[model samples]
Every structure is written in C-alpha cells, then in structure tokens.
Target: MTNEASRPAVDLYSDTVSRPSAAMRQAMAEAEVGNEQAMEDPTVNLLCERVAALLGTEAAMFLPSGTMCNEIAYRVWVDRGEEIILEESAHALHFEAGGPAALAGAMVRTLKGRCGIFDAAELETVIRAPRGHHGQRQKLV
Candidate 1:
C-alpha cells in the first residue's frame, strides 16, 4: 500500500528560488560597482578573498553560479580532452545539469557513494591514468 499524501518530500531544487530581501536589494543598489572581469569590483574581490581565506585555498574567483565556478575550475585544472573524478551524486554531476561536459569538454568518472560522500577506497578505484584501456586522466575538482 502506498501512502502518497504521507510521504515526506524533500526540496532538493535550485537555490535560485530564494528571493533577496528588500534590505539585500537596497544594499546591492548602494554597493560600489566596478568591472568584475578585471577584478576591479571591490565587493567581488573582497568576497573572493574572504571566501578563499576561509576555505584555505590559494585564491578564489567570484562567479554568478556554482555551475560556472565548478565548470571554470574544471577547465582551468584540465585541458580540453581531460577528465574529472567526483562522487556519483555530487552537485557538479547531477545539479549542474551537464555544465561540466558542456563547458569544460571533459569526461566525468563518477564513483559510487552515499548521499555525496565517497570512501577513499572508492576514490582510489577511479583515480587512474587514462590509457589504452582507460581515457584521458587530468584533474580532480
């Protein structure tokens, strides 16, 4: 027997559904603006530096979406014919909606795991040099 009404559904949907508050809009309007591509945008630069420092990364670049960020990272890490190893159910794989393949021109080796966490053993299996039996092995993001 199926209790359709009693089923608990989780909204694993896009974050763009969130609307900015009035205060946030006002803040944006008041925010000082500059060219983003040149890293001359003060706000964007500050945010990137702040996030990079928090995450302990060498540097960071601000972009419009996580899809863009992930795709850009993949492109930067690997050449046109390389590949990325990630969890089978990672946001980059499922949620980005093919941004990796479209943007980076890279193959994905999706390892199995629960939720989004992959074990070291599973990762070890996938992280191999792409060769005669394999493909292009380049980067992981």
Candidate 2:
C-alpha cells in the first residue's frame, strides 16, 4: 500500500492548485481595486452589473467564496428552527460541519440517494407533516 509520503504533492482538498496566468496577474496589477462591501469599487460594481444583466436580474453581489454563498443563501431562505432537505452526501451536510445549524439555526434531513441526487417522491417521504409546533419545519431544499 502507498503511504501518505508517496502521494503526489498536489493538494486535492481545496481549489488552490491553479496559479494566475501572466495576463491575469498583469490585469489584476493594473485593475482598480476597491472596497467591495461599501460598493465603491468600480471593478466590483461593473462585475455585479454585468452578471445582473446577463441573468436578467436587477442586481447581484459578488461573494468571495462558495461557502459564503451557501451560508448566505441558507440564512436568507431558511428560517430559524427550520430544516433543509437534502441528499446524504451533500457538501453542506459533510463539509460545512454544522454551519447550517450554528449559523442559520437550521437542521438537515438527509435522504438516501445516488451521487447526492434524489427524487421528488423520496423527498416527500421524509417531509415532516405540519403538526403545529411539535417538530422542526422543513423549509428549504
């Protein structure tokens, strides 16, 4: 069996393998950098506008990472004490390490499926029927 030291040096846990190309580096060096939270940066505003236009939406905000995006979405869509229905192998279930419960105050109900994909019928099976304040409500999928 191969040991840990025998494995390749490349890291597979995160998306840090790719390096910025020379053109990208030059563009970043020349591009105007600004405070994104205050919406004062021209580059950020342009990107948001471009994305909104492309998606036919009124506005869009650029997030730093996918984890941030997921957390924000869960906070916005799921309410406190509510639950999210997802597959057993979902990234949020395994990777986030209880962020949904801690940050959003939401719980997860996982369904058995293949490759994190489940059917509507399978979802309906696990849904908690509205029993007036007895159990956590399933809110977002």
RMSD (Å) of each candidate, 1 decimal: 5.2, 5.3
Q: Summarize candidate 2's per-residue lDDT along 15-75 as a digit string, tens digits.
A: 5655778999999899997888898899999999999999999999999876778899999
Q: Could you tell me which residue pairs clash in candidate 2?
A: none
Report the C-alpha displacement of residue 92, candidate 1, in angstroms: 2.2
For 1-141, candidate 1 gives per-residue lDDT tens digits of 978786446433345756678999999999988999988899898888999999999898777876777777887888766788777778888877788788888888788888778778888877765586355765774
Give the clash total for candidate 2.
0
Stretches of candidate 2 off by over 4 Å are 1-14, 17-20
Candidate 2 local accuracy as lDDT? 0.85
Q: Which ten residues in a row have the lowest lDDT in candidate 2?
A: 10-19
The Cα RMSD of model 2 versus the native structure comes to 5.3
Query: Which candidate number has the best TM-score?
Result: 2
Clashes by residue pair, model 1: none
In TM-score terms, candidate 2 sits at 0.78
